[model samples]
Target: MESPITPFEPAIADEAIADLQQRLKLTRYPDEETVEDWSQGIPLAYVRELTDYWSAEYDMGRVCGTLNQWPNFLTEIEGLDIHFIYQRSPHSDATPLLLTHGWPGSVLEFRHVIDRLSNPTEYGGRAENAFHVVAPALPGYGFSAKPRAPGTTVQKIADLWIALMKRLGHERFLAHGGDWGSLVTQAVAVAPGTTCAGIHITLPVVAPDPETLESLLPEEVQALEAFNFYQDWDSGYSKQQSTRPQTLGYGLADSPTGQMAWIIEKYAQWCDCEVNGLRHPENAIPRDELLDTVMLYWLTNSGASSARLYWESFNNPDMAEIELSSAISLFPNEIFRSSERWARKKFLNLHYFNDKIAKGGHFSALEVPDLLTQELWQWREQLRALEIVA
Candidate 1:
């Protein structure tokens, strides 16, 4: 039998906050990057500035406060306590929607858009578009309990999510995700006996169709270039996390600055922050919001535990063809973009294909919640029109 669900509020002890402040106070920053831009990495000057604000000016209680405002809960799934935010839409007939986040992000990524999704009428959206939203912290991330043993792969997480939704009385639900979340969402869509009605993913893990190599469209050519860039310059973190997460964890677990730099670098690199020949994370997400994500890692000391997900699942992903109803959204600045034709090769029942989102990046829910929400709305409308979702 499943463990009884319990309400949860993050009651961080004062000592934890003090310890974080003290760590920030004692941070040993590295020398400034030789280049003026973020070529080498996040500029050391920006790290110092961010750490100064984090230690001195930022409100440490905001993470707990923001999480407390949501109806949070925990339940044992597969012998692990899973933490999640559950919001039932005011519209009783609203479709059940599971929202998952990727690496370097937490359930906090959904903070801006949870209520908007759960109560669409409040945001000038049709009531028909409302969703009974469920946003869960991945195992070993955020408040979710870390796995003590190996084998908690992305496919395993998908099974846990399916079980969690059934425990919440959602027998059939829709799903959406990006990054690692997108992989899990796809896994959920294809899991045996899965009750997932459909899925929408921003990062569909479909390779370029070999057939299209000779006559690549401009979009496909740009996608291949971006993929090459990621392989060459942007994927170092994945390498470390997938291979030596434990070795790297000691510094990140002990130093708040280390954790911040590790995560914030991704935010700057992946966000749609470039303008006028410059890129700044703050250009896409606010400083406090950026720190909000970092705080989730810092407070829980979850750097290593979270990175372990990569170690367990990154090297071997379940890239099976998705036979369920599916939708794909290709934001221009996304790390791995898929052309509609490329996605068509893998997602057999892809009912919605959009590559024209004018803005946003990997962290779409946080970076461009409105656009993401509209995409969800549009995906649902398309699914409904096809009678795939009712």
Candidate 2:
């Protein structure tokens, strides 16, 4: 018999909170970057400021309160207790949708839009757009059980998600995700005998077929350049996580400042933040919201275990062709973008592809929740139209 799903309330022990504060108070400062700007990873000054704020001003109670507002739960799936937030829509026939978060993110990423998506009419949206939303914390991340051994790859997570939805009484569901979650979503969509009705991925992991590369359009060429740039300059973290996560995890696990710097640096680099302009990711995303994500990793001691996923499946050679109906929402500053022609090579039944989103980046769900929510609603409408035609 499957383990019963139990109500979950996240609570960090007072001792842990006290330990975090003490660690922050005793943070050893690194020498300042030689040159100006974030060219040399996270600048010491910025990290210090953020760490100071996190230690002094941020309230863990408030963060916990925000999280508890949602209906959270835990259920055993494949010997792991999966943690998730399941919000049923007021509409009786609302579509069931699974939203997954990626690395450097948590279920907190979807908090802003869950209510809007679930209760559309209350949020100036049509009731027809309402959805019963479920956002799961990937294994070894958030409150989910950490794997003691290996083999929890994206493919495995996909299988767990299918079981999760079924256990929640959703025999069929829609799926959406970005980053690692996107990989899991694709896996779920392509798996044999999957009940995923449709999927909308912010970052579909599709690549150009080498044979068709010679006839690329200008936009396709630009997308390739972006991909190359990421491989060259921006993938150092991935490399470390994939090759020696245990080594890197020592520092991250021991030091709260180390954890904050590691994650905040990504928000600076990966979000649609203007370096010398009026808009910064810190401005686009509230400081408190960013710290809330950092706390999840720090409190759970997930710095190492989360990075282990990269080690397990970063280069897994299992990109099955997807025949399920799908949609892609391309953000402007996404590390890499694949043109429709290239994407079609893998997404055999690509029903909706939009590369014109004006803003946001890798963390679009957090940085631009309104726009992301709108795009998802629009994509759902497109899927509905296709179903009508069928």
Candidate 3:
């Protein structure tokens, strides 16, 4: 596969600076006594502070240079020019693993944890647990071909990643993801293959049994209530992404601040059990770092294509029955979406058993890379042991 010629993207330094100025110039000030708090979105004041940081102190060169330090390459797959970072561990026995990034998130999410996972010894991990990381832009997300058409969905992406692993000469491998990324990895898992030996992830979606929900202890039931609230109040972005992404794109595409505001709310709320989690001081990544996460999307002009994934899936012909089975509730939102029997009929795995990082929010790889790396190592070991014993 031929790599996409790295395009000469506009120097983000002046571009981001100029963009921030435009935002401040033409920005329509919102009413102070507005509807409510962040529930509606990032406060105008909050975004101004963030944009101020972007224009002044935010370091794009350092971030991009750090990204460039890795072996960035482009390859052709099914006619689309794909972009990725290929880092091979020196250890001969290092396992092969593929990591997927979701909406409004670039490969930058994994940048924090790549070395930790690929070189475990330096990170207090055994050499045997090392991995050769394959972090790819979801077809339209990063440097990969941003398909402007309507057909690409998570299923197609899973197939593409499978093909990608083969292209890299790996006959077998494992997968990990979160947010939309988690859903796609799960599809790859249910696929028939010995090569895709085991899959693990932080963002999980599974079915719940109504009878079980009825029988759960009071504490368990509380979590279920929170899950239901998310489906009702917290799903607007998902609904919009699945339906009218272009409309949202119009706003997000041109304005850097708009893009930051669009994704920052989710980063603040979706990764944690509560909105307060976004403000947690002990969190591995601070809110400023979270703004940096949004800037990646803004600088790359990915908000449109990233949100396009929603419309593709929601309109999928196979949408009638999304197969998701789990014996345990994975995310707080899954409780209200499906029943255990239904999920079983759909997804091969039901995760009703764990809340691993049940504390952290979506961008887990970026927010808490150490926690993500350590947990991923443990998951692989558990999967290996289970496969051997079985």
- The estimated TM-scores of all candidates read 0.99, 0.97, 0.83
- Ten residues in a row with the worst lDDT in model 1? 313-322
After superposition, candidate 3 runs with Cα above 4 Å error:
1-26, 33-36, 192-194, 217-220, 273-284, 314-353, 356-358, 387-390
Highest lDDT model number: 1
Q: RMSDs, each prediction?
A: 0.7, 1.6, 4.2
Q: Which structure among the candidates has the greatest TM-score?
A: 1
lDDT for position 357 in model 2: 89
Tens digits of per-residue lDDT for model 2, 64-105: 787899999999999999999999999876899999998888
Q: Write the per-residue lDDT of candidate 3 for residues 1-390, one digit (tens) a residue.
A: 343434222235676656656664565555653755666666777777777776667665644665676777777777777888888887778888888887667787888788998899999998878899988888777566788566677788888888888878887887777767777787676655535766665554544455566577554565567677877788888888888888888888877777777877666565543544344321445655666667667666778788888888744423223333222224433223333354455445543334534444566677557767777777656655656211
Q: Can you tell me which runs of candidate 1 are displaced by over 4 Å?
A: none
Count clashing pairs, candidate 3. Answer: 19
Displacement of the residue 59 alpha carbon in candidate 2, Å: 1.5
The residue pairs that clash in candidate 1, if any, are none
Model 3 CA lDDT for position 140: 71
Residue 210 shift from truth in candidate 3, angstroms: 3.4
What is candidate 1's TM-score against the reference? 0.99
